[model samples]
Target chain A: MQSIDHHFLDDYACRNALRGIDTRIKLILGLGAILIAISADTPYAPLFIAIILSIVTVFCAEIPARLYLTLLLIPASFALMSVIVILFLTGGGVPILTIPLPWLTFTATDVAALNAFLILSRAIGGTCGLLFIALTTPMIELFSILRSLRLPDEFIDLAMLLYRSIFVIIGEAVAIYNAQVMRNGYSSFRKGIIAISMLSSSLFIRAWDRGEELMTAMDLRCYDGKFEILEPKASLTIYHILPVFLFLSLAGILAFLPLPFPPL
Target chain B: MHIMEGFLPSPWWQIWVVLSAPFVIMGFYALRRMVRENREALPLLAVAGAFVFVLSSLKLPSVTGSCSHPTGTGLGSVLFGPFIASVLALIVLVYQALFLAHGGISTLGANIFSMGIAGPVVAYAIFIAGKKVGINEIVTIFFAAACANIVTYVVTSFQLALAFPAEVGGFMASFMTFGAIFAITQIPLAIIEGLVIALVFKYIVQLKPEILIRIGVITQERAERLREGWA
Candidate 1:
């Protein structure tokens, strides 16, 4: 089973030449693309954005095509489910199809279909923007950005510790899960629940102990109440900033371009 | 249960982000106070946040005989308070978005509102009310956990409904549709979460009653009485 806490893309990000690019530039550009994608009134605009973003992410960022495809599909089930609901609930505008059911009548209209398409495109576009950043930037760099933003010390410290402890706790949970499997502790559903409950309870206790030990260690090191870590200085050049400006300008241009299809 | 990326249109997502801001700010204040009062709480809260993230990842057998993940917010809310639970939940949500691709950053504010603010607030309320009514400790824990899980989905449904209301019946119809769709899975998951949380609460009471006392979830006298009974 793939570990939920692990990010395969982060390793790629570390190796990618884009790792040295300023995180702030990436953050702004990514967010700008997402905002444009979301606010785009027409499906064509978002569709264009999604394609361009995908090309940049997979090619420029050196993210594996297979990994990019997998990440894009992560939201498929959710987006499909909501789109289905929207299709069913929305009505009026040249009925495409209708189905009579025992409980309720269902109708699909052109407007509804258009709405679903818009949602799908926008969602994909927004996801592409997010993937571009997540696939290219490491969490430490993101955290450093947060630090540079001058967020609350407590918030940053807690986030740092939480990030570190995730690996530790996941390791502990996996160990217990393997031990349980070896013992056939999950042979039945009831047994599985029992085993999982025990696993969680034990994990909680162990995490608490770990936290205490961490506190003691930090204190031994003359730890102040606040945590302090050095932030990496990112070098930004015109070469790095050019792509962002170009992308933003391209998005703006696409937004104004007339759509071929009739407005929904 | 998260609204997907770009799921909510412009104004709705922004509205949720603005609404959720106060709770997150309050959570910051609560965290600062806790750390100031007890330096040890800093690490404890971090570990607690990690516990939430890990626990949410674990797929447990639901009452419907299907596997589902528990939210884990309720357990944290009971152990800590709602505010700190909200902060912990935001961290967990951010991690999930970054690594698991389970949720998105664009909808982070909405996710925080539902999973972090609404769910934990409801859980905290239920816990307080259940204690005031002198309910069994385990039963109260069960209600707190179960209600929190259910409320998170409920709020999510509302968020979705508000964003994409039905053309004919409007928000109510869409809300009902979303609610019914999620209820099929979430109800059973919530019950299982409740039971698991209750069992964990029992284990903590038996093994580390002092934690409950220290967190002010239970009074020192109450902890002593419970320990004496177990003894």
Candidate 2:
């Protein structure tokens, strides 16, 4: 239950100074950074991109540095784990290190090491780009942008309902979990499993019932097939455009650098 | 079973996004049709998506004395079928990526394919097979959920291997290594997920058989038979 609140990042984004920036601009630039990081062959490009993204997210976006680092580390751990596999299982062109295990001899080659480094940098760099957007932009802004793109009404409505229901269902879940704990429902591992199962089923039923009630309420309010909401217009000024342009050019230059790195 | 953000190289990630697009479009069409036909299904589907989000995000104590999260897609697939489950899973993945930083936008296509498409397809297949075989309902639910969870990881391993194959032994070798590493954590977690889903299914069977019947999970006659058997 405690971890549930930790997952809500949009609230943080809304409080940041960058909240006023155009969501569309952030979307384009953020996605551009991700693409550049992924397309870059050398580790230098991604590493540089990651550094720039981190700096912008922390300083310009005003997201706490500690929180930003923690976010980066989440993907970094996964990248490291897979990178380790790539380093050890891959072998060729003069072994850099060799270790004899009980079952198999593990060897790390120069080529594999470079490959692992490339993957690690790219993954981390891509993650940073995503984090920058996520920490600066709210979900409502993204949905509005999606609406402007003329996505189908039903899809947008469903997304809106689903987004609202997340918090409601999580609240219900916490209440149910608390009641279960009071009854010592999770005293043992087996009991914990059973308790969780019961909690989930209960949540399903409650959600279903709430959905029914919601439908009835909407019908009473003369609900049609579409759920309508006003979209906020984001002002695109030079101030907003300049930073994105500068960031992209820097990223592009880093990506096109003539570094002696293995090709992907 | 998610491929962390930007884990895949450019071509591989883009390819997955392209591959997943058709399924998403099909799912959207199905959802629109269902909503148009039965207006009541709109809210139900929304709640189902939210349930998936919350259920998967819950941190539960595992048998290993550590904590793990459930995929929750299998149960959704059982109730709503694969297409709608794909939509729900995609939404959940997007939310996790943006909000929790648990996954990445660049990897959304890969995550959706693995968790949404592959997992639900496997779960639905198993559910249909179980119904055909007249297997015990609880056992069927267990297998469906567990198998779906494992298949997601299996597909993810294949994806990673394809992207970063070993220098010497190639794709199969890399696949085996990634698969084995994931299995250490994923296999047991999948089993636990199965048990949890089965228990939830049992609870629903007892309390709201009509919901299952409405969703075509079981016919009214089958529900009656299940009730009688339990009684």
Candidate 3:
């Protein structure tokens, strides 16, 4: 039997403390913070949002700190690589440091360092904002929110079907892969290519078959060409809405204020 | 080739969002029409979208001995036309952003534009041109897949250049810098993806030529020829 954790973030979203909070509020806070963070000039606001939102996710939402950090490492790695490049390649203001290499000399400028820092902080803040939504609000709630927002019913229905199919197809792909590995299907470069292609093709056939079954089932049920969305049980309360509003406003206000510290 | 969240700051992200919206809107209409024409197409399209997501998540062995994920958009565009492929890619990108933390919500517009719209459009165009010119089916599939993968990265590089031009050399130099970084990892992966997708196309032709024919991916004559050659 698969544990609840088998579904990864979805499991957490279903069980989190903030899960009962209205999704619209969560979305607003998350997206509002993201917009503020990305558009902010200094690193302070984004860095603040990053640190605060992370604490909320880990403590308030009760997400595992280790898992959260590990998930964060994905975007962090990309940010680090790009920031290093920007630090060395982007030139402005006073020269900060110069290192000589065999092929080329690298120089870091004050402006470049600041720019890189700003970008890195923004990336962190934005990721935290996104993860907050991912961890606290399940995709089902999001779909309902989209529905309420008056998105096309057909599009929502299709999105729901696609979402459901992803897990089924992933399970099939995984089982096939394990079987392939057991049979030494990926021993060599050529063999590996063939194995992967075979895996993909078989998976494609499985999806096609699954699609047909779904259609038949829907038809049997007198398919109305629309899916009924389970309205999110969470109700709008001042308790939920107020905090998000206050937090976003705080982040927004902080975004415009100048930092007290001197320039690098 | 996902640009990390908040990587595109200010006007750049907004610009990409604006530019990508039109294509996505068109894709949405195309999707609705496809489903309306034949209700059965709805579930198949959904599953096809899921297939694209799963295909991208798989690790492929590259020439450099390192493993990477294929974009999977080329095969999608070939199987479903570019318009529907764009919608599928959009859904996949959203899922990846939410579940995998591999991409950011803020940059979804840019990512959708690159991996979803531009790549599929190019792939479909290449496949059509290849067929029109009577290119070898296998070779055409390879190039279509490979070029789609490469073009996604190239467009990403272009977005980066536009966002952060180098101080000395401006857009051209920044583009070269980003392009070089992408080409190093991406070119090899693209080649591997091309080869794998070509093989997958071959397998599909042999096993389920009817599906391809139904989808208008290949004519009955070509499917017959492919089946015979493979057999």
lDDT for residue B121 in candidate 2, whole number 0-100: 98
DockQ of 1: 0.66
For each candidate, the DockQ is 0.66, 0.75, 0.63
Off by over 4 Å in 2: A1-6, A262-264, B64-67
Which runs in model 1 stand beyond 4 Å of their true positions? Answer: A2-11, A256-264, B63-67, B220-231
lDDT tens digits, residues A1-264, model 3? Answer: 110112447768888888878888899989998999999888878888999999999999999999998889867656765677678778989989999999978788988987888888889899989898889889999998888889777788888999899889888887888888889988888888899899999899889999999999999999888888778577889988888888888888888877653344
- Model 3 clash pairs are none
Q: Give the per-residue lDDT digits (tens) of candidate 1, residues B3-121.
A: 77777888988998899999999999999998888989988899989999998887777655332678999999988889999899888988877776677888999999999999999
Error of 1 at B77 (Å): 1.2
Best by DockQ: 2
Question: How well is each residue in A18-86 modelled by candidate 2, as lDDT tens digits?
Answer: 888788898888899998898888887788888988988899888889988777776655676688898
Residue A219, candidate 3: Cα error in Å is: 0.5
lDDT of 2: 0.86
Taken over the whole model, the C-alpha lDDT of each candidate is 0.84, 0.86, 0.85
In DockQ, how does model 2 score against the reference complex?
0.75
